[model samples]
Target: MPRVADGSIPGGPRHVALIMDGNGRWAQQRGLPRTMGHREGVRALKRTIQAAPDFGIECLTVFGFSTENWSRPAEEVSDLMGLVRTYVANDLKRLERAGVRLRVLGRRTGLPDDIAAIVERAEQTTAHNDRFLLQVAFNYGGRADIVDAARKHLDRVLAGETGEALTEDILGAGLSTVGAPPVDVIVRTSGEQRLSNFLLWEAAYAELIYQNVLWPDYGPEALADVVTQYRNRDRRFGGVESATARVVG
Candidate 1:
């Protein structure tokens, strides 16, 4: 493995998106309230973020709450919202001190005023950090993101920017994840194989890996193992064999 000056696995992917699933199932398996599992999942997220740099991950995007999640029980949704507030309250200072820049992706209009304020505070407070980027996809959906991007692009066109032709770059620029690098690998925990409407556009060519471990049980070891799998794969961005593409069985 290639190592950086700080002994990090420099050969690993630049960005890793995680589908944090199975929290409720985990709690159910233990006969505990599903909300309890979400709390534990938050702790797991903390651990993973702290360990990401060591595995060569510059940006980590995690799916926290999806747009479709609103269909779930009200109590569950409230609990989920509470978890976000608790996480920010307990970890924001430490994350800022660690040089981690935080960005919460997804629709902000529907969020409660307090949550919206908290989100803004988290982003602004850590805006200066550059050591790493953490994007939490809350109330986000892949299809919805595409539509939002499309709507923004349409608005620009309607506003007499007709001279500018529509292109992939034009549409991509409107995405919530526009500034972040394209995802290198997308991992779904709890043995799930589906993207579940998470980072659809950004993950166009990202390698997908599903882990048997649940989200609450995930940690550095699991992340490192996924990076190893990512390293062993042959990634061809539509072209044939190239010098940079690895051939592994």
Candidate 2:
């Protein structure tokens, strides 16, 4: 619950999901290697983590590597994997020092054993840290997550736990971010206007903002601006009429 510099805004979103895109296009536009953009994007991620609390963000879910990203060039994929390794192996301690809890939200069945081990270590190390929750969506797809949740409920039902119909709460308990608050805002960088298969279930009522700024260029100021925009939004969920409408009628 870190306060902004102005300390005027009392509260803001507890959860924010980000679609970090345009690394390859950004590098190509600058006539540099895409790897450089990825590296810079990591820097931007660190900056965002540092700025999260100032914006009143309790949980941050970032789309790190989607399942579809595996179709990219082999070298780029390797570079991306290397970055994951570097983050989990090296930067994890930094997260620990910063009191940020790290959670990887995705399938881990066929992942590299080394990355899996590091992920285990990171999660264990930060399990008790209550300061911040950071969810990295690696090998994650929204549809796949929902399917997994369904399968989990099915298994429970088969075990005779509940013979009745499945409710949203029952299924939500199986989600990776079950304990955290639902996403309040979704921000995509690099001018991308699509969810790109990010958080499907949790974003049912999320306010989305697409920015033209590349992921590598997103900094603390960008985060502040995004939060400012979120603050100005009118979140009515679905209902347009208030309780007083019945009295008026």
Candidate 3:
């Protein structure tokens, strides 16, 4: 991992989520096919995955594909799916060797059977690794996640298990990311400031960092900057801090 001029990130977040944007724009800027940008973005993903453990991050969730992404040109979508297959086929063993557990959080109904099979196989193979949990939100949408969880909860209630008195814990249990820690910080690249339907429920209190850097160009140094910014903030969670407690020891 490449280190910044300074030492390690101070008080880095435990869980980080990323909305990787601007692949198409990056490719357009370079006079290359958009598919090439996606290809390069994969390289960036590899870099981030390798660097996360170095920063002591326990979990990293990346927005690989959203439900809305299906609306893009069919050719582009197909290319993205091919990229997914390539990543799993080419990198799964390396990821497992590095102690990274792979998890996919999304509805798999629309994925090609072969692609879905690869996802399942990758998850099963990496299930025992514990150094870090890497979640790829492929074909995922925050609102869709909430609705799916709610439907499951309602079904349980109707089946005489528990009725109408659902709490956050009960609801959360049905979500795809039930056991994972909530996102601590969310970074959106490509100068976009919107969350774009990524992890709405889990990111309720997450500090967000928007960067002008495109996804294909993001590296460990950019990630370190996000961590540095997170460390500088005073996270009071919604309460006023005691005067003495507010002072840094």
Candidate number achieving the greatest lDDT relative to the actual structure: 1
TM-scores of all candidate predictions against the true structure: 0.95, 0.91, 0.93
- Candidate 1 vs candidate 2: the lDDT winner is 1
lDDT of each: 0.90, 0.85, 0.88
Models ranked on lDDT: 1, 3, 2
Off by over 4 Å in 3: 1-10, 242-249
| Of candidates 3 and 1, the better by TM-score | 1
lDDT of 1 at 164: 77
Best by TM-score: 1
In order, how many clashes per candidate? Answer: 0, 0, 0
Query: Per-residue CA lDDT of candidate 2, range 1-249, in tens?
Result: 335576534446678899998787888899999999999899899999999887778899999988888899999989988998887777888888889999999998767898788778889999988889999999899998989999998998899987868789888888877888789899999987989889999889898999889998888898887877776676767888532233222
The stretch of ten residues in a row with the least summed lDDT in candidate 1 is 240-249
**Which clashing pairs does model 2 show?**
none
Clashes of 2: 0
Native-referenced Cα lDDT, model 1: 0.90
Q: What C-alpha lDDT, on a 0 to 100 scale, does residue 84 get in candidate 1? A: 85
What does candidate 3's lDDT look like per residue over 183-212, in tens digits? 889999999999999999988878889999
